[model samples]
Target: MERTLPKPKGIVIFGFLLPGILINLFIIVIPLILAIYFSLYKFTGGIMGDFVGLSNYAQLVKDGKFWNSFKNNLVITGLSIVGQLGFAFVLAIVLQSKWVKFREFHRTVIFLPVVLPAVVVGFVWTLMYNKDYGILNKLLSSIGLSSWIQPWLDDPGIVLYSVTAPIIWQFIGLYLIIFMSAIQNISSEIYEVAEIDGATGLRKAIYITLPMLADTIKVALMLCIAGNMKIFDNIFVMTGGGPGDSSTVMAQYAYNVSFGQFRLGYGSAVSIGMIILSLLLVLVIRRLMGGTNR
Candidate 1:
């Protein structure tokens, strides 16, 4: 007779998931519901006012500042895709190469920034971008390229990109580690076979390693989309959407509207707008990537 294993009891499974369920209910579900409910009213002065029925959202549609911030968010997201994911992929490939030495050291150094507090990274980069005495301008001066120096944080034209740079630098290591792990899981025999067939490393990476990493790449792209959509702390600490709202993102705008201007109803609407937009973008990405996590 063949041996059989017993299935877990429903109560046991529910017991195991109880803490997570409760946490989500209190932390995420409840807040989201309240935000939606509050969004339907003219909530202000710490009291829910008369129902406005999407008037706040209607105003948000015409709000120039909100759209400007959304555009800035798009720019940051695009740059993040190119900078963070792109560089991480390249670094992962290089580190996986047999010719590279001190792989562990390189990994550690690259990932060190990811573990640092976001506020700390922001402050450090802000200091580095200081035009008067900052290291960036000083380095340019030292290299006889002083013209390259600009008011990095103060200039509206370049402030967005300036804030974006530190964010990219801080997070590259995370995706680098992710890709490296995915690459490691690719079988050695596949590469060996490609090598035996006189295929070059580049060809093997393109044809074999890349195809094998399809699912992992999809996951990475999704993560990038979601994370960049709501990016806040780094830009907040660095510029506070400064130089007259040049680098403001959706999250920061919602914050300013809620706390800065004391417009809780509109702020809740903005918050809901962010959630809807993020979900829609994620859905589009999923569809474009073939709509399967497999």
Candidate 2:
């Protein structure tokens, strides 16, 4: 006689996690594993069969172009984070003030850019920065500053910073919203007590408001760092990593290596490196911010 068997316990557990597991495997784990595998080979003429061991990584260490791209990324990330978060916090504070009129209208106007597509922002900024007959140049010319106008995307000196202008413009609104929410979460009682104690506006901000917003600052910093580290679309559309690769970040460099030059192995190595860097940065940021009880 045939006997029926009970369903395994492990199967039930697996079923519970199946959707998330499948998504992670397909979206993150599989691609990571494939990248590692590809990084061990040397591709030539559409062939990916030759294994090169750790040579790809070794070459990465000696690659000036990779370092240059990495430096550009660092600069861009630093500037974007500082400019975006600093001004966002200021704007949040200003909007929270009782004296500010039409707060909702101001918030809506600031947030409009956050909802725009990155490509659209890039194209719009490209037109604004165009040297010849572009709005920016025309405006400067009208103001008798035409000599100061230059090819924003073509100048190696200013290309990275110029492209970053659009990025900062697009994302500052999101951070502003984050800061505003955090500001609103602060209790009115605390502000009232501070005022009763003869605390000035600046003093209240320093002692009470900022201290309460510490956790929000940490979260905002993490998001800003991660987003800036992996920046691509804005740079791609605005500059195409051009003007002698002045604005090329690791993502753009990896794309160029993999698809543009068919150096799949090198590109995979770059991708893996980027992943490692991202993980390290996240861990470091978490540890630093974890000290705050909030």
Candidate 3:
């Protein structure tokens, strides 16, 4: 079948887009320009000093702490891909099943965490992860698995993962909803055909659902990457990037440099580096995921 439609008018399109363009100009473009400008100078205490071009960038290149924080960001991004997306995939499938009871209620419960403040999640999980007199240890000891109970917030080796837990757990319902929405949008005729062809259960998921949901999965992965790379509040409330900086991620690290240490220029440089690294990593992932395909 052939289809025809009225062409969009240029004046009307521009009028519709003008507000968004102006907003981005102020919110994104101007700030980006200012960041670049500040990165070229030595600025501190709300004062701009000597313009040392590329020196801030040079110093950042030699900054071990910056690199360490970046490494932690990568770790979080990797874990989030598996933890959030993988868990959401399974949960969405379970909830979508015909035999499930009170599925709407379950979905509402799952999604509730998404609306909670990151600070609240952080504080709540911090108590949950406390080494002494905490719920985790009590449960483990009750199950006769006290050895499995960990110093979640204390140990440097595990603090990063501990802080990562609530961060990963918080938005899982969101990705689950995205996946479920995608799954629901799929045509029933396709499933009927799959049934006729003896596809069901795991076979149905693998052959019909997954392939059909590939685009949605890509979208979910992109959201996961962005969220993990830019995460701050919850981890800050939980760990403050500590246990000797073991839990430090790039965002919080830059913030500490900017505000805590008052090294505005250096912080700007770190922020720029984070922006670059995130773009590069996302682009690499997109390439690997065959992003150009429909």
lDDT of each: 0.92, 0.88, 0.89
lDDT for predicted candidate 3 compared with the true structure: 0.89
For each candidate, give its TM-score against the true structure: 0.95, 0.89, 0.92
- Winner on lDDT (1 vs 3): 1
lDDT of 1 by residue, 152-191 (tens): 9999999999999988999899999999999999989989
lDDT by residue (95-212, candidate 2, tens digit) is 9999999999999999999999888898889889988768988998999997888898999998988998888888889999999998888899999999999999889888988888
lDDT of 1: 0.92
In model 2, the worst 10-residue window by lDDT is 42-51
Positional deviation of 86 in candidate 2, in angstroms? 0.6
The candidate that wins on lDDT is 1
Model 1 CA deviation exceeding 4 Å by range: 1-6
Pairs clashing within candidate 1: none
lDDT of 3 by residue, 131-208 (tens): 787898889999999889998988989888888889789989999999999899999898889889988778888888
Question: Which regions of candidate 2 fall more than 4 Å away from where they truly are?
Answer: 1-17, 44-47, 285-294
Pairs with steric clashes in candidate 3: none
Backbone clash pairs for candidate 2 read none
Steric clashes per prediction: 0, 0, 0
Cα error, residue 160 of model 3, in Å, equals: 1.4
Best by TM-score: 1
